[model samples]
Target: MAMFRIFLGAVFAAIAIYTIITGTSHGWNLVPVFFGDMAAMNWPGQFNFDFFTFLLLSGLWLAWRHHFTPAGLLLGIIGVFGGMLFLSAYLLVASIRAKGDIAEIMLGRARASAIGKQ
Candidate 1:
């Protein structure tokens, strides 16, 4: 599990980096285009909304799991703006930190819920 996490994380981080580099070609003008895409009111618009919903969930999870720390907030913002590229990599790191302990990974940094067990 640890190895898988590391491997997947590396892949995601690399992909995200590549995406960032590629996106630079578009410059900042896409900010308005982003809103326009969301406002299209067609299948593509629906898809955009679907992705936004996922982004919201990702941000919520990050904030919830990281004890609402600054790092958590920052990552949440990144997840919102950077999308799955940031999220997959973040999950990879978290999974690696869990170190094959499913409970720790699922429960975030607080394993109190799994304490006092055999």
Candidate 2:
């Protein structure tokens, strides 16, 4: 799972870089073309990328630090699977920020299993 996450993150980062670079070349309204309405058009509001990115990364971080359960798991899964072909760069940063929480959780589980054997 971790390996998968890392790979996905790398891919996402690439896309984000591409977007940052090419995004302005095309009309800002051109919208990205990808699987999940990658280029969907919408009126900018609080829901724009600036806000969305912050919320998503923050949520991912929180999800990792704490037990986000069904919803968090769903978000991670969606991010890993659904997000790969789209804006990967943003997800990459999010995954990087999330690494510590993920590591801590995995370590805790490892210790639990190890102690349980004794």
Q: Pick the TM-score winner.
A: 1
- Global CA lDDT computed for model 2: 0.52
Question: Where does candidate 1 stray beyond 4 Å?
Answer: 2-14, 17-25, 112-118
Q: 16, model 2: CA deviation in Å?
A: 0.4
Tell me the whole-model lDDT of each prediction, alpha carbons only.
0.74, 0.52
- Mind giving the per-residue lDDT tens digits that candidate 1 earns over 1-118? 8577777778787887776776797665655766678898877778888888998888877777778899988877888886777777777777767766667765675653547363
Candidate 2: tens digits of C-alpha lDDT, residues 6-93: 8877776677777677867864454333222423454454345555575466556435633577875665555543344443444444
Off by over 4 Å in 2: 31-118
Clashing residue pairs found in predicted model 2:
12-88, 12-89, 13-88, 13-89, 32-38, 32-39
Name the weakest run of 10 consecutive residues (lDDT summed) in model 2.
30-39
Error of 2 at 43 (Å): 28
**Candidate topping lDDT:** 1
